[model samples]
Target: MGVEGGLKCVKILLFLFNFIFWLCGLALIIVGILVQVSLHNTFMINDAAASGVPIVIIAVGVVIFFIAFFGCCGAWKENYCMITMFAILLSLIIIVEIGAAIAGYFFRNKLSAIVHDSLTEMITNYKNTTAEFRDSVDNLQKRLKCCGMNSSADWKGFASDGNTVPDSCCLNVSSNCGKGAMTDPTKIHQEGCRNALETLLKNNILWVIVAALVIASLQVMGIVFACMLMRGIRSGYEVM
Candidate 1:
């Protein structure tokens, strides 16, 4: 009787853990969408690697969501096969998640490396792109007080003139102050935008990495409860 009662509690705990996993999946989806919007729409950073971050988050969330639902159903039905499958699937997910987290950790610094390329693409195609995109790049330069991805010289040939930069790169807010003034230290900012953009990416991704590790750690408890319940069911005991 005591063993049955303990198994019942384990079953209940597994159910609750699955529910938590469901909620966590939803949260991750929301976070991923918001980050996606912020990085792509707001910041206009369309870098391949940078844009992929949110996509992977959403994918992981979807996987977790489905697996959580499966686990719930398996627990509710007290099916040993279903429960074992859930455990196996969840173990695979945990491995994938741990790998992702470790990759994120290593890639945190490498993320900044692409900033130069992304910014250069934007600046090079500034006029060819839509007005909104132009405004976004201009806003970034102005807000960061930066001229180009690497240096003010990046704006060479940006205009019909031999050397020029956008007015946003000027220390003083004015029209056409950047024309032929790329090398004028007093006229415009010489620093690159890499530092600013890199900082933003790193800070945001750091939180995501931390949250994933925490959730992964908590999932271990659910796995334990699942295994315990599976044992009770497999022994022909009345786990229900």
Candidate 2:
């Protein structure tokens, strides 16, 4: 009776572990799906520059979740064939992660150089535009002086007159000025460059290292759990 009770306790523990694993795997899968959807939405709203990191994260999450789910199912069913399949899949995931980490380490400097070049070009363009706009504003302020009586008058008409100002300067000041005010071109460029660099580091190297370690550890745990399930299933079969 004591032996039977002890076996029952072990079986219950195995069942609980299998369920917990499955739940965590399913949650990760759902998170991956959501991340992918968000990435798509970001791309639609802006240029293609916004989609890289989320897509990479989704890919990693999906791979981990599917491998874990299969392992849990294999353990729960106590099927040697399923267990063997999951083991193979986990091994492949670990290898791929390791390869990614190695590639990222070697190419990191090149990636940084590309990001810096792009950012420098963008900043240069922004500085040129800003200087031109500031000069135009200074020139206009020097020419126009509206006192209390003339302040409420139509300065647009005066500004448009051929005798008062050049047609080129008067042409759509609001449109040009509004765009400059609404968008800090320099800041936008800097942010884009920073994001691109961060994506490479976080997704390619850091995440690969972390995921590889976790998956390797989990695979070891999986082997031990599979053995336990096998013993329990065989014992149960014999008892019946």
Residue-wise C-alpha lDDT for candidate 1, range 1-240, written one tens digit per residue: 889999988988899999999988787777777767767775687666676666777778788899999999889889888899999988887776776677677767777666767787888898798999988888888878888888888888688886888888999969889988999999999998888878877777776677577778878888998999999998878865
Best by TM-score: 1
User: Which structure among the candidates has the greatest lDDT?
Assistant: 1
* Model 2 bad stretches (over 4 Å): 1-57, 120-208, 227-240
| Candidate 2 vs. true structure, TM-score | 0.46
The TM-score values for the models, in the order shown, are: 0.82, 0.46
C-alpha lDDT of all candidate models, in order? 0.82, 0.43
Instruction: For candidate 1, give the lDDT.
Output: 0.82
Candidate 2 global Cα RMSD: 13.2
Q: Model 1: number of clashes?
A: 0
Candidate 2 lDDT trough over 10 residues, lowest sum: 146-155
Model 1 error, position 163 (Å)? 7.5
